[model samples]
Structure formats: structure tokens, C-alpha cells
Target: MNDHPHQSSSLTAQAGLPSELNQHNRRADDSAWIEVVQHMDSIYADLVHYQVELEEKNSALEDAQLFIQSVISSISDILIVCNINGEIQQVNHALEEIIGKTAEELLDKPISSLFCEQHLSLIAEFPEHIRSGSLIDCQIELISSEQKEIPMAINCCARFDHENRLSGMVVTGRPLGELRKAYSALHQAHEKLKTANLQLIQSEKMASLGRLVAGVAHELNNPISFLYANMHALKNYQQKFKTYIDAVHVNTSHDELQKLRSQLRIDAMMDDINPLVEGSVEGAERVSEIVQNLRKFTTPQEQKKQSFNLILVIKRAISWVLKAAKTSPEVIHNYPAELNIISNEGYVHQILINLIQNAIDAMDHRGQSKLVITVNKNDDSVQLHIHDNGPGIKQQNLVKIFDPFFTTRTVGSGTGLGLYISYGLATEQCQGDLTVSNHKDGGAEFILSLPLEAGK
Candidate 1:
């Protein structure tokens, strides 16, 4: 009966144990669920923080982009972006403002189309320049929507991608109207300064020449006067001797006369004395004429307009040149005997002397020299040609022959001032033109054209 009771109690305890275990298992499950909920809440909070941070970063990126656009739009210089093919891809507001065209209209157009002819031609070289990674500053002209041309100075550089590959170009332009105007003014000023310098140099040359001529004339005056006086005295003595000889009596002994003639050497003296005296007189007169000519050259030339024989002046110049050169080259004067022109005689003389002397010098260099002078007269002007059979001037040096201090002769053999002064006298003083060229034959020909009534 005790074993029965113990078994019943064990069953009861087992039933109570089931209930107790059920309660304990429920509490453990609740604790585990609470921990799982806490872990999920923590994960949700971290995700929310990440989303908020991402949104803030996106907003900052947008602001930076907007700031760059504003800066590019506000800039006054035209900013252009072109693709590798030089096609316009983007342009700033400044470009639209300058050309009065919207970016939409220019988006696919060629960048070269906006440039003028000259700059358009340079488009073919743009790729090479870009390839070299060089910045080019070019003067270009831009055409506006209304067809107005605007000058600009553009600075262009190549653009590259993040991978360092050429993608496009960036160009900035500035208006160049004011700069071009400034440059033009500077160029004109430089030309004026050059002209003034040439005039000053010419003035100095004339002044020096005047001083030299004055000194030479002063020195020659005394000698020429003495020579002239002595010549006249010798002539008078010859005349007296002739009278005395004529007064000799006819009854004089032949032997006595023969002895007198032998003692005096009368025949030989008579044959030589007159020519010697004539030559001396002629030389003195020539010296006197040269002195006068020198004085005329130095003195202030008055435009004392008068009618004078041109042929006579030419002959006088030729004579003076022949005397100075001491060589008789054939000079053919093809002109009217008494062609007269109204001008300053002294200046004309100066011109002819210079031309003739140049011709003579040229002839001096040749084995067989010839000079042919021809004159042509029309109602308005006269043209004189001095042609010589000497080596012609080089084609390269022809243009510079009249420039001051330009010469091909040895240093002391020629003063380069001759042709320059001749040109100046012909153009400025005589109101004429002097030009030179090689003749058909192997020689140089100088043509001088003068208005009949210069200064009229």
C-alpha cells in the first residue's frame, strides 16, 4: 500500500514538474527575444545616420557645381570649349553676349566658322598646336550674329581628361580694337621719326660740304689772282718783244742778225713761248672759274628763277669734268643747241656736274669707255639720259644705290654722299626725278626728268 502511494505521488510530481518546466522555458524565450529586438534597433539607427550623411554630401556637390557655373557666366571674356575635332561643345554666357547667339545655336557648329578668313585658315594647324600642349595667343576676328566683325586676341590651350588624354580645347578671347589702334599709332610715329632722322643727316651733310667749299675757294683765290696777273705781264712782254723785232732795220748785216738769232735762240723760243703762255693763261682762267663755281655751290642758293640755255650748261659741266678727269672719253650730246628752261641755274649746274662726274667715273673702270647723253623735251618737262658703257650696277644693289653712305667703291675712292646728294638736289631742290637702271647693253643709264618750270 506504501509503494502504491509513492507511485501516485511521483505521477503528481511529474505533472507539477511539466508545469514548472513550461514556465521556465517561456521566461528564457522572452529574454532571448528582447536581446534580438535591441540588436535590430541599433542596426536601424546606424542606417538612418548613413542616409542623412549621404544627402548632405550630395547637396554640397550641387552647390559647388552651381558656384562654378555662376563664375563662368559672370566672366566678361569669351570662354569656349571645343571637342577634339574643333567643334563647339560649350560656351559661356560671355560668348552668347558677344555674338548675340545662344549656346544652343552654337553647340554643334565649327569653332572656325566664328573666325574671320585669316584665323579660319589657321584652323588646320590647331590640332598640331594642341598636340604639342602649347598655349597659343592669336589675333583673330569674330563675327557676330548681325554680321558685324569684331577683332579679338584669343588665348587657347588644350584640355585633357582625367586620364591625361586630349579631349578638347579651352579658349579665352579679349577685344583687340584698342590695342590695334595703339599699335598703328606707334607705327606711324616710328615712320615719322625715321623721316626726321634722314632730314637731319642730310642737313648735316650739306653744312659740312658748304664749310669745305668755302675753305677751298678762299685758298684758291690768292693763287689764281697771282697766276692771272703774271700771265698778263708775260703777254705784254711778248708784245714788246714783237714790236722791237719788227722795228729792226733792213740794212742790218746778215751775219750780225744770224749771230743775234743764234745767241737768242729766237726761232725755237718763238715756236714754244706763245703756246706755253696761252696754256698757262688758260689754266689760270680755268682755276678762276672753278673757284667761282665753288663759291656758288657754298653760298645760299637763291631760287633766282631765270631762263638759261640747258645745252650751254651741259657743255660747261662736260668741260669742267673733262678737265678734272684729264681723260677724253667720247661724249655724245644729242640735244637741241639752245634749249632753254626757267629754273635756278646754280642747282641745274650742280645736278649736271654730279651726273657727268658719275658717268666719267663709271667709264674710267672700262677698257674702252663710251658715254651717250640724250635729251628729250616736251611741253611740260625735259628728260635727260646719261648712258655709259661700264659694268652695270648689281641688280640687288640698285635700289640702295641712292641711300646715304651706300657704295661699292673702295673706302677713299668714293664718297657715298655723291648719289644721295644728287638725288636730293634733283627731287627736293630741282623738283625732278632721278632714276637709274641697267641699259639693254652692258651699262648703266641714269634718267633725269625735270619739270620745265619747276616750283610753278
Candidate 2:
């Protein structure tokens, strides 16, 4: 009975041990399952964040691609991107339209295939030339899809990669037909502008002439009146001499001839005759000179340049301008007796007249107006300085003075083209320069620099 009870206790202990073991195993399993679930949740969170970041990056990449495509499509110049082997890799919309093919169809095409057969040798040399340096305005004929040859002015430059190594060449060109059209339009516009400029110059010249008409008339009247008076006196003297000569020819006695001479006052008439004759000749010469100056000023100048006396032209200009000037400014000339130069004398005369006139106009209403003109010789040029004792050009107006049609004067008093045309004539026609600045003294100074004759 003791052995059986021991066996029962042992069996009971063993069964209780099995139940405790099962409970321990379940707790351990629950802990492991909880750890696995926490790990899975962390991984899912990371994956979600990465997915969002990837979507944003993909959106940015798409935007960049669209921007590039739009730029390529918007270009008007035909653009071709090629590989080192001279095979076209990509092309812009202009190229696509010109070639009459889609981008897909043109891809991988040999660049030389687009050019005419005559230019194949030159086209083959382009890669080597581009590698050395950029080729600019290279004119070649391109073949269209229809086999028509189209002239093109293409510029090529080496295309470099991120590594700074030249990979291929990028070619950009425009059809010559389009370029010719643009050039033709530009030429037409230039022609119109030239015509308008000529008209403006003529109008300004006429206005200047009109302003001086009264002075010119007065100038002519003085000599003409002198001539008239001298001619009338000569006519009376001739009549007296005729009566005395007729008396002598009629075989009058000595006493009678002496009486006739004394009666006619022949000796006195002789003295007056020389004076009248000299005076008439002087008046005639004066009239001739005035007419010549007017003809020179009014006539159309020839294009050919000639050697002329600069001093004489200046004096004549001063005389003409001062005669018509509303203000009687004192002019001081400090120059050599004569300075000869090779240029268009008429243009120079016109320029000096305009300058002198402008100076006179500026000095108008100013008390004791004075003009000082100084000439200096340089290595290759001569400078003529015209300084006026008037209020210097306004600081704001100085820059705009040479601009066409820009003026500060009253509307009808000036055409504003005087200085502009003067500048053009100085620079363009005479191969000289005209510049102005405020003098150190209280005045405005204009400097005209002109090239000297070849040897003198």
C-alpha cells in the first residue's frame, strides 16, 4: 500500500509540471508575437514615407522634362544635336518642320545626309573644325525631304558633357530665304530713312536760306545802288566830252576850242571820270563776289572732295551769318592766314555757316556778346574752336543737342536739325568730328576737328 501511494504522488507531480510548462510557453509566445507586430508597424511607416518622397521626386522630374521640351519646341532656329560620329541624336521643332519629318523619323540620321552632295566634304570637316573652335555663319546648302536644296547659314559649336569633354557638335541655322527676306526688309527701311533724311536736310537748308534773305538783299542793294549812281554821273561826263570833241572836230579856232573846253569844264570832268570809273568797277566786283557766294551756298554740292582754303571759307561763313544775325556780336578770329585741306568745300562752308549762325543765335539778347574762333593744327587734323560768350547750353540739353529734332527753342524759331545735320556732315561726309562742351569761361564751345591734306 505505501508503494502505490508513492506512485500516485509521483504521477500527480508529473501532471502538475506539464500544466506549469504549458503556461510558461504561452507567455513566451505572446511576447515574441508582440515584438514581431511592432517591427512590422515601423517598416510600414518607413515604406509610406519613402513612397511619398518618391512621388514628389517623380513630379519634379516630370516638370523639368516638360520645361525642356517646351524650350526645344519654342526655338525658331533649326537646332540639331549630334553624336561624335556625326549622327543626329535630337532635333528641335524647327528642324522637324523644315525636314518635313517627325523627331522619331529623324533620330539617328547622319548629319551629312541633310546637306547637299556638294557640301558633303565640307560637312565631314565640320566635326574637326568644331573640335578646334566654333564655326560661325558657315553657309551651306541643306537638302529638304522633297530633295530641294535650301541655302542655310549655320553656326556650329562643340557640345561638352558634364565632364567638360567635347562629345559632339550643336548646329543652329536659319534658312537663307528667311534671312534674305529680313535683309531685304531692313534694306528697304534703310532706304526710306535715307530719303527722309535727305528731305529734312533740304528743308533745313531752305529755312536757313529764307531767314537770311533779307540780309542778302541788303547786301546786294548797297553795291547795286553804288553802281547806278556811278553810271549816271559817267553818262553826264560822256555828254560833256562829246560836245567838246565835236567842237574840236569842226575845225573850230584855238580860241573857240579853248572857250569850249573852259565852257564844258573838260579838265574837271576828266578828274571825275577816273573816280567814277574806279568806283563802278569796285561796285561791280563786289556784286560779282556776293553772287558767287550765294551760288556756292545755294547749289547742290558734288560728292568729290577737293582742296580748298579753310580760312577763306571761314571768313565767308562768318560774313554771311553775321549779316543775318539779329545780334551784332563781335567776332575774334585767331587763325593762320590760310590753312588748306582736302575735303568738300561746300560741305565745310555749310557746316561753318550753321555753326556761326548757331553761335550768333545763342548770343542773342546777351549784352556785349562776343565770339572767339581759334584754330590749331594737329599731327593729322586741324581743330577749329568756336566759343561764344552766351549762357552755356543747359546741362540737361547738352546730351540731346545732337539728337535729331530735339530742341529747346520756341516751336517756330528753330528746326532743331541744325546741330544734328551738322554733326552728320562733320562725321559722315567730311570724315571729321564735331563736339561741344561748356567753356571754362561763361560760354559754350564747339570744336570741329577735320583731317588735313595728305602732305600739307
The number of the candidate with the highest lDDT is 2
Q: What is candidate 1's TM-score against the reference?
A: 0.43
Model 2 steric clash total: 0
- List pairs with backbone clashes in candidate 2: none
Error of 1 at 330 (Å): 1.0
Off by over 4 Å in 1: 1-302
- Across 308-410, the per-residue lDDT of candidate 1 in tens digits comes to 8888878866765665574679888899888888876666766677778788887786777788989999988999899999888999999899976677879
**Shift in Å, residue 373, candidate 1:** 0.6
- Mark the regions of model 2 whose C-alpha exceeds 4 Å error after superposition: 1-36, 212-456
Predict model 1's lDDT versus the native. Answer: 0.78
Query: Which lDDT value does model 2 have at 8?
Result: 49
The alpha-carbon lDDT assigned to residue 433 of candidate 1 equals 94
Clash counts per candidate, in order, are 0, 0
